[model samples]
Target: MNHFKIFSTAAATTLLAPAAMAQGIDAKVNEAFATVTGPFVNFIFAPIPGTSFPWIVLWLVAAATIFSIYFGFVQFRFFGHAIRLVKGDYSDPNDAGEVSHFQALATALSGTVGLGNIAGVAVAVGIGGPGATFWMILAGLLGMASKFTECTLGVKFRNEYADGSVSGGPMYYISKGFTQLGLPGGKILAVLFAIFCILGSLGGGNMFQSNQAHAQIANIVGDYPGWITGIVFAAIVYAVIVGGIKSIANVTEKIVPFMGILYVGSALVILIVNYHLIGWAIGQVFAGAFTGLGVAGGMVGALIQGFRRAAFSNEAGVGSAAIAHSAVKTKEPITEGFVSLLEPLIDTVVICTMTALVIIISQQLIMEETSGHYLMNEAGTGIATVGGNTGVALTSAAFGSSISWFPYLLAVAVILFAFSTMISWSYYGLKAWTYLFGEGKTTELLFKIIFCVFVVIGAAASLGPVIDFSDAAIFAMAVVNIAALYPLMKLVKAELDSYSARLKSGEIRAFKH
Candidate 1:
């Protein structure tokens, strides 16, 4: 308790020091981060020449497409099997790993199913119009293939430590799988992946989450220094993550289900209440998908935004989920891959789509009948926002427009989603940390401490460049990871074939539950 007070006091001094000083420091921090990371961020998210489309998004989509074809659309063909695997029907208690298959899926889901679902969907619908939801679902469907391939490799190449804990992810797979293929630059790629993963874990997974979580809280409780929320959040996160993967899995397994049901349930209630508009909304989604419904860039704009937000929300090809899935206790690496297919489906196809439908059904996008275009802001580049609100605020207004108290409930869900995401990513960053610095108690603890500290900083400061760069860092991971996946995919396919043959022949049978 004494240590807690001391730490809180020191953190407050550093984060809250008079408003004027804090503002200056925040500006300097953002500027410094922008100066250092701006070029890299631009390069990572750079648009294709003469086109608005981000090549990175294309890179991920292309990979998802290739894997879907190469694996014969495994995400769709074996999705039922994936559910059974998650249910422990094929899981052996004697398998070598840390967490159960369900726990692994929960952990991975926790990472992907956060702010991107609530705020991100609103952003996609806001700019891309209702049509974006159509493409978003398609991208997510294709993205399941990406998740399946990477997670299979994640489990295949993971390092099992003497103490029974395991470490794996794109870093391990890139290094080991590349060397196995007798490729050069395996070590270099591995190091680069670890570096980016750490940065992504800190910036996107830790800071961005805490920042939004604090914003939601401040929205509810009048106003206070963001550091206060940060400090409290960090303490709770530290308590869970310090216990390692098992603890994280335990928390996420509970939180993910509850928060998912709560958020999804709320969206369902609103949709039912507005049942009369359901057909019109569905028509809008289909029509807008093709016509762009007067949205800028028309169909193409919707396509880009939908694909972009789905990729961001589900993180299918990002390789972050691979880290969480790698800890599953399964001898057949393909089983985890099968289980992972459900992630993008739940995060994107179900939850993200639900959010999009609610917003669309709520008639949040105002259209001018004479012009047949959305009521745009002064610039007229995109759909106009309500009272200048965007992201979560916009989503909240849409919900509040129906059920008056839903916004408050949504706030609680946001915090829970944020908290769950932070813990899952903590494990992800730790795995990368140990891979780079060597695994040990002190080594792991150090990363955890650093992660917790960043939570405070993230909540307190508005480091836009830092968050942007962190997001780029995540895509940078996809660049390296998907690049490696192409070469290693044949190996994953072989595993899939063998697993399928055995299951078909009754050699691999589900346990009697």
Candidate 2:
């Protein structure tokens, strides 16, 4: 208790000192981050004249689509097999890894399944209209292929530590895959991947989770100091993560299922109450998906919105999920790979779709103006500045229209989502950090302490530009990961063939250690 108080006080001081130092601290932080992330975002969002989507996003989508087709739409063909694998029907308790398949999926899902479903979907509908949801679902479906490819490679190339620990992700794949190919510059690419993974872990995984979680907490509990929330959150996270993958997996398996069911159940109720508008909402989704608002220059705008939200939500190609999936206890990497495909499907297709439905159905009844600009009213409840007109609060308003308790429920859900996300991300960042720096108890402790400290900073400070950069970092990792996978496609196909042959021959009736 004394240590907790001391840590809390230090966190408070650290978070508050920046604001106290200079009147222009906010501006300085924003400017500094903008300087770094600005060009990156621009590059990613560069328009493609022939298509409505940004060139980078389009390229990613096209890559995922072709891979899915090339692999015979493995996501669709083996959906049942994946389900069976996750059910532990093929699980061997003595498998040479740390966690079960279900637990691994939970940990991975915890990272991707949070605010991206609730707040992100809300933002998508607000900006892209109902049409964006359609594209988001489409991208998520294709992303399954991306998830399978990266995670399979993750397991294939993973390293088992001397202490019986494991480390794997894009860094391992980039280096190992290239080395196997006898390619030069593999080390450079591996280092690049490590750097980006660190950035991504800090920004998207850690800071972003802390920021959103703090927002929801503040919304519910009133103006409790940001540092207080940050400190408490960090402490909880530190405790769980210090114990490693087994501990993280245990907590996530419990939290992810409970939170997911709660949020989805609430959305289901709203949809059921507004059942009459279901058809209209579906029509609008398809219409907007194709025609857009006619403002984004037709199909191009629609495609862009869809792809952006999907990539952001599912994070299929980003290589982050591979970190979690790598911990699964299995000899057949393909088993875990098949299970990983379900990440995008559940995160984007199901959860995101639910959030979109609630917003679209509510919007139709309110007849509110659909513009991407924030509107503040005297009631102290309005659209957020960052999201323009289509933000989380707007979706909250829509939910509030049908369910009086929805705002509070959404707030709670957001907090849980954010909290779960932060804990999972700590593992990802720690893995990356260990890869760069030597892995020792002292090094591990230092990273944990820094990670916890940043949680407070992310909560108290405005992280608009910082998160943007982090998002870019994630996409950049995807660029490297997918590039590696392209050359290693034959290896994945070979594994798939061998696994399938075993199953067909009934030689693999069950999992063996």
Candidate 3:
């Protein structure tokens, strides 16, 4: 058999194995995948000379910072305006788009607010220390501008179909926007972006979400075969994506709001109950931010972890949200930009910070008294776990210490989060897939079938090089994406200027009842 067939068969067997051996199978599969994926991870995450920050993090941070300055901190200036746009302030009944601004925001949020918040933050704090939380907030703040720039370009350059369907994203913007500017490398960047997005959609967006979701499920119920969870989840995902079923997507979108609110609310309650240590936790986060110990580069270690996790969680500069926001029903592209800036804020700053605080306040990472609240004697190292686990399990333990039953609810939320995220990413991957393969029923169904099968593979496997490689693929999109952003950002800024001029002059008035 060919490699794909052989690997798929092996994955199927591993996942279907007995529970006692399933976890081992997971590790072995992960190792096998890791052996191949390790080089890519090393290249992507390799530290700078005498520092721990990866070039990818710096690439994204640079884009975010430049845009924040170029737009005069538009993320801040347009903050209120974004809220209004999402509230349909300037919506028209005759608008030509597939979804409303609110729907677009919700859809984008659903894609991003998944395992990264649940498991990624734990990984960050687990290794980089609580100080990582501080830098994550900063990255999220700066990342808003990148979101604004890309989503605006996404809509501005989108291809509106004859049937009112729209396809917009970095691909559209990179190809078309560069063409408009007489730029030489737009097509190259766009094509590269689509390729990475496909890989990312399968790995980080699809498999990583499935893997973590399964892990959370196993945490709750008795340990069953990972393949069992994977197969069931994959079937459900296949049903939603294969038939172009809008109803399932609608149901998912609706359920996501409830799950999200409850999850955040639960985080707040965990904090509120531990009010006594809130300051100490905050102090720990702040202190560790500057002078974190242990780890390779001290302060840089914390910076890297915080920025990496935030970028992964919010996807501000990666251009995925541009696709989701492009579907918003608005004539002006800048409005979508405004609306999208809120994504990273909510995902990384608000929600992610809450998770960090809980982990810190729980004192779960304190290896000793001298380690401080969020600090560890050694930085860049994971703390010892009672269950000898990391990722979502660590997050669960931190919360369970505060609320014993929270794990059950968290499992439900994780599944829901995974479901909604997968559905969103399925659309993302489909767009990229069709971009490369062209649009047709057969082509579409082919991709969906492959996606469903991988979901099973992802859930049945363990976290290691496979997940790392997938995450790297997602960031690889950023490398090409930011290249396009530099040349195309001026177009977005011009749109922002016009939108502001019109709004200030009362020409962009709200719709009257």
Candidate order (TM-score): 1, 2, 3
Q: Write the per-residue lDDT of candidate 2 for residues 162-188, one digit (tens) a residue.
A: 666788887887788888888777778
Best model number under lDDT: 1
Q: RMSD for each model, in Å, please?
A: 5.6, 6.5, 5.0
Count of residue pairs whose backbone atoms collide, per candidate? 0, 3, 3
Q: List the residue pairs that clash in candidate 2.
A: 52-300, 372-389, 373-389
What global local distance difference test value does model 3 have? 0.78
Question: What are the lDDT scores of the predictions, listed in order?
Answer: 0.84, 0.76, 0.78
Worst-scoring 10-residue span by lDDT in model 1: 1-10
Name the top TM-score candidate: 1
Evaluate model 2: give its TM-score: 0.89
Q: In model 1, what lDDT does residue 326 have? A: 92
TM-score of each: 0.93, 0.89, 0.88
Instruction: Name the runs in model 3 displaced over 4 angstroms.
Output: 1-37, 243-249, 293-297, 364-389, 462-464
Which candidate would rank higher by lDDT, 2 or 3? Answer: 3
Across residues 1-513, which tens digit of lDDT does each residue of candidate 1 receive? 000000111222322223442467777886787788779887887889998888988998889999999999999899999989988888888888999999999999888887778778888899898899999999999999999999999999999978888889999999999999998988899899889989888977888788778777877886788889899999999999999999999998899899889999999999998887788777878888898877889999999999888877888888999998999998899999999999999999999899998887654433332344433444545555667777777888778878889889988987888898899889989999999899899999999999999999988887666777777788898898888889999999899999999999999989885
Candidate no. 3 TM-score: 0.88
Query: Cα deviation of 294 in candidate 1 (Å)?
Result: 1.7
